[model samples]
Target: MRPRFVLPAAFSVAAILLLVSCNRGDLPGKKQLESEQVQASPVAPVVSSKVVEELPEAAVSPLTVEQRLEDFDYMWKIIEENYPFLEVNKRLYGEDWLANKEEYRNKVAAVKTDDEFFRRMRFVLSGLNNGHTNFLSKEEYPWFLESYIRAGLGSEPWVNVFQQSNVLVRYNQKPLTEQQQSPKESNNNVNSGETGSKTGMTSGNVKKVIIEPDQIAYLGTRSFAGNLMEMDSSEIRDFLIEVKDYKTLILDIRGNGGGNSSYWRNNMVPLLINKPITYNTYSLYRGGDYSEAFMQARRLSEGLLPIANIKDEQMPNIPPEATTMFRNYNKNVDIVTPYQSVGFKGEIYLLVDSSVYSSAEGFAAFAKGTGFAMVVGGKTGGDGLGTDPLVAALPNSGYVFRFSLQMGLNSDGSCNEEVKTVPDVEVDPDTSKPLLDQPAIKKVLELAASQ
Candidate 1:
């Protein structure tokens, strides 16, 4: 649920053209800059050059205690001003944000090294209990590549290979003659030629269309991050078109950590339902003077940007009074119309697991709430709380951190934060085996065949 006003480059160009052509009579006056309150620098007493040389190099390092304090203060101010879930977090976690800040500031003052500073910052962020929030230091950037790879595959290298090979063998019930990788398994491998790879192995794979004995079509992906529309236009479209003749469809997203929601909205949902639907009932933003200014800038740049293109009658008309407050600054209700070209109209089964998070959780929620699919597998990782997180950099250490400035609500008007989406048919995976070997998928196959 990224801001609609944050348009693509081409869209921004179009908006600029529109802005230039329109009258600027309604634009707000330029804000006056407040007078700066400058703090006086401590004066250095005259000292001998020889005394300075005698001091240890470690004592004169750039990342001094004072510098770390300054960094922490900067971070604290930003979160205090912008974090959207302050009240919701208090209700959910009993968090006293101001108290936590005071406690953490004391800890920051005690930090003796750069590593300690980073660790303490991470500890403070972890207290939020929001998976979307994280701090990544400059030194940790290189670690991201390795960590990402490990996250996709299991941390244990041998276990990942064994699990993938075992799942394939078990599902097909036949030893491969060539021991070659299937497109789905190949897609997961870092060495594979694909440009971008998404998803961890939490979800089962539906790489190649496997038509079971009773005309059940199985389609699996590890993630929902890439250009699914292009994938659909090419191989997926061909597969779905072929599968339209099948009796039932099983869409697997077992290990998927969510990506962009548009992949499902624009490419998948249209193929499933014949009519328009409302998925997201409402959304809330952390509004303040800053947010108001931000929204005004966006509105000026991109006038009345539509979140989704639904029929006129289907749109949720948000009242002007609702938009007046800080929390409701950019709040919106989303209405999605199905893609008109999709023709599949059969029983749909969705496979989910703890790895399914963020936008993927939204999919599971929508499907379950709308009775669109019979959800199977373990409860999905409930991470649909905050929309897109806003990123900021630490002034001193150059470390980057992200925090969500908006909280989304379910169709029932409940906050999505920390609310796990349970499956209709629960199937726990065997710890010793791959998720694909779990009875959940087997049950889906059985149910699909019956349908």
Candidate 2:
């Protein structure tokens, strides 16, 4: 079985309705809201406005009052059962989503068209304030259902949760890339001056000595979402040989929103080390559809549910009501690095920023958990730990959506989603400078040169 990794979300209300970004979409970089501003702000957007391309509109019909209410209640029930962030929302943002059930019902009841129903779902889902929690687009519903099955979630019931009464007429996966760039431009090098690998985005300009900072081998990417077809392994392979003798290796994933974790496990870790590193991580989730389905999907290999210890210290700061609603989950992932002679053995420094999220956030967590690297930079966008986003569909209308089903907990017992990944050497990203020239990279490079 593939190593169990819990899932990956974005939308402020408008961004989601416009289908601005997707759970598995190729959105580049966006900073998360400051803690002081989360409550009033829209959830951090998933796709970059620079690359916004709309999905084809569904030839959808409006639901009747009965149908609308049924869809509303079904959507609410999905959240109530599987969503893991209810208390986190209440505690962090002062948004009491649990109390707004009827209000959401009224909004759903008030929607007059399929478009209106879609927007209403977006509004309700965005209220959770998690980038990973939102409704799936008509185009993405089938995509997510495929993901759910691929994730090994129990197939019998939830797979049959609702029939696709409205199959999206013209869902094209390549549209975003195509719209963003013509065939001529799409394969061009990332703005970074290096040009060998189009499959992965590592650029050689990352190594240029800037000012006083020492020249460091920079293997950077804005995303790890690159494993659709075989990645040109030669990029990482040949780059490793090029930088093998450098004192420090900079794994710069500054604006990355994460994709395939396998990229790191198969490529980065194995090339760097001769030993295995076991990462013990924890999550908090309800014993509902997602949790239970995943539980069945990957049993005892992870651990049993409803841990006996009732200590408040083990749980993150949330209302007593939430603790009552959820149970603890834990897993130990062993990354066995397969080292080769030309593989990089230098000190690895992970460069990150607030835009580092999802699986990128997982890199930070893994670095911290297993001593894979010294993390340097700002706090990352959270929601890194836990399983893949859980799949759901409204029973009445076959309207599909997904949301986070678990809260990633840090070693210190703080919530990863709330605390984020705090760098060992923290530096706020200065937007005025080029991303690679950020203070953290400069500081760490100077430190790397000295050592």
Candidate 3:
């Protein structure tokens, strides 16, 4: 399925002005008031004047109630037509979807400001209880950093922790440890300079690779985003080659919000297995009026033969050959064969948490099902059942929204979205201490040693 492309918002001038003013020790009372309002109100407060000045002139125009209503209607229609898990959502919400739509539409009509309208629409989308289906308004995009700072959950602490440990770290497309460590200190490792095979390979989503004191190779991958699998594959391949002799490998995907499933199937899985494997038993989508055509087009676009391209005329009196092809096409089993001389022979351990979602959750499910790796840590964020999402933009607000177009079944042919992939050794993080100091790592190490 084609992943939805979310349009990036232009940089907000209002946000920049707010930051500058704050740096200059201005708007102390206003900042406090904004925080209080954010905490008290159901919706986040509107962007302050300081932020408004920084925003582009085009975004300053006030949205009319009619415009907001139109946007709401557009979003609602898209979800109503494209959203695949209506039965699942009905089971979840226990209300008629149409009734819920009417109720939200009435609420949308009453919204006055742009922020209020966005919030109401967001609330309506949240009713589906699907994280894959949601909205992020333009106003919320720029103020994300400010909100994080006010909430006291900035990245400073995490950076400090990694720096203090003197371990190589990469996050947010930057080399954190490389910047902190001296040239002399950095020269001691294989990753310090441009080495053959690892040369020109950007870290991308591979956050950190550190060989622990116990000789267990730990790799923290934050996301499977973009073409990171291809970008970071060489680095991981070379790292695995270098650490091939290590007894254990720890693939930490604690906070990995997944991107592409092909990452695991094509890049990672080949390096871990020596034989052919079937990761998904069967993949099917909800049939609709245009479902056959859609599937045919999708297959053709993906460079696959549209063997199940059943015509409207062929529906009632389908040919025997086409019927067989349709059955085969519907049961789309994902199979992969290992790369020669690239498979890892040592034991593999996967670290996960509730933040492990989307393709990450799929990875965990596959690993557990195939016995490819032993998962350790908390249950996954549970995004495996929802298929690829369809992106739609609001006509007036231009706010982007995504909803799943299909429901995926687990490897075992289960449609249980509520049942998250549990770890083999469930070790929760230590809330009192930093993640680096968590006992979970110790438990993983112990488990590895025992194995």
Best by lDDT: 2
Each model's TM-score? 0.62, 0.72, 0.63
Report the C-alpha lDDT of model 2 over 301-391, residue by residue, as the tens digit.
Answer: 2454564453534645433543587765543334343545364556778887877777677778777666778888888887776545655
Task: Supply the TM-score for candidate 1.
Answer: 0.62
Q: How close is candidate 3 to the true structure, as a TM-score?
A: 0.63
Error of 3 at 450 (Å): 2.3
Task: Report the CA-based lDDT of candidate 1 relative to the real structure.
Answer: 0.50
Error of 2 at 313 (Å): 10
Better of 2 and 3 by lDDT: 2
* Clashes by residue pair, model 3: 13-54, 13-55, 14-51, 14-52, 14-54, 14-55, 15-51
Question: Among all windows of ten consecutive residues in candidate 3, which has the lowest summed lDDT?
Answer: 15-24
* lDDT score, candidate 2, position 254: 76
Q: Which candidate, 1 or 2, has the higher lDDT?
A: 2
Residue 426 in model 1: lDDT: 88
- Scored by TM-score, the top model is 2
Candidate 3: where are CA atoms >4 Å away?
Answer: 1-56, 59-67, 86-99, 139-215, 288-297, 300-329, 385-387, 430-437
